[model samples]
Target: MAFLGFESKVFMAPMAGITDAPWRTILAACGAGNLISEMAAINAIQRKNPKSWQIANVKDEPYPVVVQLVGNNPELFADAAKLVTDLGAYSIDINMGCPVKKIVNNHAGSALMCDLPLAAQIIEATIKATPLKVSVKFRKGWDNEHINAVEFAKMCENSGASYITVHGRTRAQGYAGVADWNIIGEVKSAVKIPVVGNGDIDSPQKAEQMLQQYEVDGVMLGRAMLGNPWLLHRTHHYLQTGEILSEPNASQIRQMLLKHLHLLVNYYGEHSGMAISRKHIGWYVKSMYDAKRFREQYTKLNTLSAAQDLINEYFLRIEA
Candidate 1:
């Protein structure tokens, strides 16, 4: 459970295009025990793709950073793992849980699940390439007809992976149906290494349930943490104590949103930062009254000051 020096059991999953430096910084501040960098392609990193390099950046984060790499080639995986290790990654995570079409088509991501030998090869190569702890994140199977998570997890453990994380859905499910926590439990029973259960853990209660029901060493949060980093802290607290903490109030939510915007702007310049902040703003207010109208108006605004004014106005109206 202490892989890569992480003492806390709650982790933030590596979400492509979402779990960037700014967001990871926010989540770490909110008490995430460990953070995974957005998934970067091995080929892109080897080619020195600027955006891929940017995606692997984990500067200024307080917690341990795990750089997740996706690829089919063992040599490329080793090269990419070394790159991230030089960048100060605390550990390297192999991506076999991503079900995106482009990634799978390239023989990466969940596609690796169908070819267990190659998956083990990539894990072994990466582990040999760096002293950093190497881990693997994978799904239950290629589909419901092919549930191989237990077999695949044992292979990964045998190939020198320090830990394993299982997302309770098959590749065909693709975020559509409920995650089968039973499969996660099965994998946990099969592996001696730490197993982290992922998928459908959107709340503190569900997180606690995953630990109890599945008997996992930890839980990983993905979409659930979007615009709601407080989930990490709350889940941690709930697991430590039997009491549930109150949700963030209106003022607290507004303040956090503003802080997120500033961090985005500081990391990315105003033009691109404000463009991305719109989506985050939408996530933050999705449950608010008149949210649809507010999102429509908010997305059209161009300047940071204008966006700030509108957020203030919207919250004032909510208070009224």
Candidate 2:
């Protein structure tokens, strides 16, 4: 259950556009057990795509970072695994759980769930290519009609995957409906290696529930951590003390948002950083009063100063 030397069992999921180096560094400081990089396309990496390199960058993280790669080609996966390892990745995670249409159509991601033999071959190739521990993240199945997580977990374990993570839904379900924790439990029962449960776990209580009820070795959070890195800290604290902490107040949330903006600007440069900050800004104000108007105003931001000014104005209005 050791997660490449992480101290906690609450992990940040490898969300494609969200869990980049800047955000991972923030979560690590908040005591996230493990921080995974955004999904890196293996073909893009092999082609020396600059955007792929940017997303895969893990240089500043304090903890050993886990880089997740998505692709169906075994040779390309092997090559990408080695590249990330050379760039200082602590582990390589195969992306069999991504449900995006583009990825699935490419015969990658959740599509791999339909072809267990190829998935196993990819795992074996990546493991053989790198001395780093390799893992696989997959869904319950391709659809409700094909519930093969238990069988897939066994294949990954037998194929030399160090551990496995299972999202509770199938590809057909996408992010809709409730994630079936019972299926995660089934995978846990079917595998001897560590099993991490992902999906629908957004709070400390939910995290504890997954561990106590589903018996997973760990829990991975994705959408839940979008603008609430404090959830990671709160989950860890609750696990240690059996007491839930108060949610971050308006002031605290504002400060976190400001810090997030600064980090994004530092990492991605001002223009692109401000562009990317739009969605995060919206997430931060999602629960606030008149948030729709604020979001409409925020997405028009084209400069860092303009974004900062708008954020200050928004917080002032909340305080008023």
What is candidate 2's lDDT per residue for 292-313, written digit by digit as tens? Answer: 9989988887887887788888
RMSD of each: 1.3, 1.4
Model 2 poorest 10 in a row by lDDT = 1-10
> Any runs in candidate 1 off by more than 4 Å, and if so which?
1-4
- lDDT for model 1 comes to 0.88
Q: TM-score of predicted model 1?
A: 0.97
Count: clashes, candidate 1: 0
True lDDT of residue 287, candidate 2: 91
In model 1, what lDDT does residue 147 have?
91
- What is the per-residue lDDT of model 1 for residues 13-48, given as tens digits with 9 covering 90 to 100? 888878888887787777645777899899999898
Worst 10 residues of 1 by lDDT: 1-10
Clashes of each: 0, 0
